[model samples]
Target: MVMGGKSALQQSAERHLWMNFSQLGYYARGKKLPVMVRGEGCYVWDEHGKRYLDGLSSLFCVNIGHGRADVAQAGADQGKQLEYFPTWSAAHPPAIRLAERIASLAPGDLNRVFFTSGGSESVDSAIKLARQYHRVTGNALKTKIIARDIAYHGTTMGALALTGIDSIKEPFAPLLPGGIHVPNTSVYRLPPDRTADSLAEAVKRRIEIEGPDTVAAVILEPVQTAGGCYMPPPGYFARVREICDEHNVLMISDEVICAWGRLGEWFGCERFGYIPDIITTAKGLTSAYAPMGAVIARDAVAEPFLNGDTSFLHGFTFAGHPMSAAIALANIDVFEREDLLDHVRHNQDGFRAMLESLRDIPIVGDVRGTGYFHAVELVRDQDTKEPFSPEDQVSLLGYLSDELQERGLIFRADDRGGPVVQLAPPLIAGPAQFNEMEELLRPVLHKASELFPHAR
Candidate 1:
């Protein structure tokens, strides 16, 4: 029940603009791109003027929802005062306030905030900082990085080296050196009788095999985003923390998608009841109205940078844009005024209940995630929990993704886990929106099975 979007604007963009992360050949061939003109609350309208629900929060940003006069006005006011100022050695009011506010939200003396333009930049910055920090502190050989398999750090060459998805990085061969990957704590694929303790042990053993003295950090998402919205069994994170403590590996919790009330807390580290040495965040910082990202370092890492000739030696030009900082501060005000964190904690149970109802759907193998972020993992066999092969994955996503677009809900078709539909709706999403999502997904999911009759 949605109209096919765009005509003239699509024609113009196709001719003039080069889109990023796209199948250019297919897009250039006659298929019109749906130009998103504007967003309000949880919905966005296309160029042809058809509205669709923003289930992914426009890339898991927009925590406080959309079209807020307060956040927008803060940017305008800051622009009037001082529109452009670099964050070299000089400091600004908005950036200072945002840093203080974020420090308050972050756990365990994670006081240092290094700003960036977006999540990828934050990852890249954090990694370089970790590498340099160890080099200056007499552990230069500890420069090797160990991140989770199937983990997505970022897209930049440096960050991409840390990423674990081979499919994405295969073309960019001979990547940066010494970046290693340990098995993720995804219990579904592990030993049949694996408990939380065993999974943590497996990760620790892998770290030992790599020689802990050589490893620098372990970058992880509190709930894995790429591989079908994978959530670790309980006690997984606490044990990871313990292993890192015993081996002296820095734990970098990538909260790009889980921060800012996404996990019913300011940071996913706090929500999951563990502390990480470094935290990378973006997306929901200014509710997607502005691009911004930050790397918060704990006292252990920041202390070394305080004195001596030690220097991290890296940063971005638009790291802390005045408008972005000002807008982010305003966004924080909105979180406080509306009690958005508590709102997420209150509503998450209802949201999970609604999603669990889809378990009856033939292809739904599992429904997992936390707070405002969740995903439905589809499989070929529900009981045996057998996933379709890679070839079948393309067919399902190509068919179902567009079908869901027709159903008026926008989400991620993550084939990283057979086929998963990632849902990180705006923090403003509640029972009403949850019900609508379930209603829309059920029939369409049922129809998806029809295309793969042999599998089921």
Candidate 2:
């Protein structure tokens, strides 16, 4: 059970496991990594039996919380009935029924579902769907997609093109072309002349400059996650919808992290009061109990393919896998039975209040977001709104990244959006969970602020 003075699990992870978005060199340097072995409710336990609050919902996906026996049982039962099947030119009961259920829950005419294995694939599929929809409708030149700066769409090549973060995309150069970037709704940093609608107007201007006929779709998250939960301003999406309609471009709501009650609604677009032509979703679709995603298209978008002898040339082997479909159905059952959406709606204000109270700490620059997803932006000078220098960011975020974990809290301390602490606890979380988060966050952030005297 031991190898080189480390447990087999640790050794194996260091030698063989390649974690996503993680620096493997950290583990290779013989640092002890926290190996999570069990999860229940709003907490997860490491191999050493240390319990940490699942504040980020294990990456903003575990909406129903962890270790749901019913959800797991559904997959197991489905496996016994039909272990695996492809939805390509064939249908299974779980996929058929789940699609119908999702359609019923989705807004507008987003009834047709094209399945994928996960979020990245969902985004990739959506990108292709938009282009194909345009091509099929006889607009072959409509190929470009416009996305927001600092938005994390996905990691696949197509999705990567849509991702506006330069750090992650540089090495994967020569990505799919025609991916344009626009300013995001980080209203906290907007200049005085810029109004709330200015963010939405950026999309309009980009579409015009790109030649409206050449832009296939506009992809954006309801509340952008990479740049630390940048929420949309009032009437942003509605204006975007109008712009897209005026230009005959598709609006794609990339709801991989925002859907499935993460925003206190079935879909993030619903929360924002606008319906997109296509919705690319995953994550809470099955509450992360199973890897599944779907690109839901409005009736008009799916119409061309549904015509006689015409078909959408796209699919995945595991798309609508029977077991995942069953798990999704079961997950939805739990959502309805527990009324988790209503739970979030009832509790979101208190959660926001708890995070807002942290503004008393000098390092806390801004507290923003909705429902269960929120972020506390770190700053060096709150009065002047001065950002932390690169070195200061390393010192502040590094201390927080390690200190919060040592304090048995699993929240995100990231500089992806310039020094931020993101929190997206499971939707089942309530006041007690919020209190626990505050207790852990208040001190760690206080200690972090001490790293910069100006912040203190």
Candidate lDDT scores, in order, read 0.85, 0.92
Best by lDDT: 2
Where does the lowest 10-residue lDDT sum fall in candidate 1? 1-10
lDDT of 2 by residue, 1-456 (tens): 766777888888888999988899987887678899999999999887899999999988999999999899999999999989788778999999999999999999999998899999999999999999999999999999999988889999999999998989999998999999999898888878888778899999999999998999999899999879998988889999999999999999999999999999999999989999999999999999999999999999989988787778888989999999999999999999999999999999999999999988988899999999999998888988889889888888878888889889999877887799999999999999999999999998887777676644
Candidate 2 residue 91 Cα shift, in angstroms, is 0.4
Candidate 1: give the clashing pairs: none
Q: Pick the candidate with the highest TM-score.
A: 2
Please, what are the lDDT tens digits per residue for candidate 1 over residues 1-456? 333454667767777888887886776776667789888988888866788888899888988887898899999999999997989989888888889889988898999899999999998888888888778778877777777788888898888999999988999988888788876766666656666567677768878888887888888898888886778778888988999899888889999988888999999888889989999999888987799999999988998888966667997888889999999999999999999999999999998998899887788888888898888888888888888877888888888788888778898898765688889889998888888888888888888877774344
In model 2, residue pairs whose N, Cα or C atoms come closer than 3 Å (at least 3 residues apart or on different chains), thus clashing, are none
Estimate the TM-score of every prediction: 0.96, 0.98
lDDT of prediction 2: 0.92
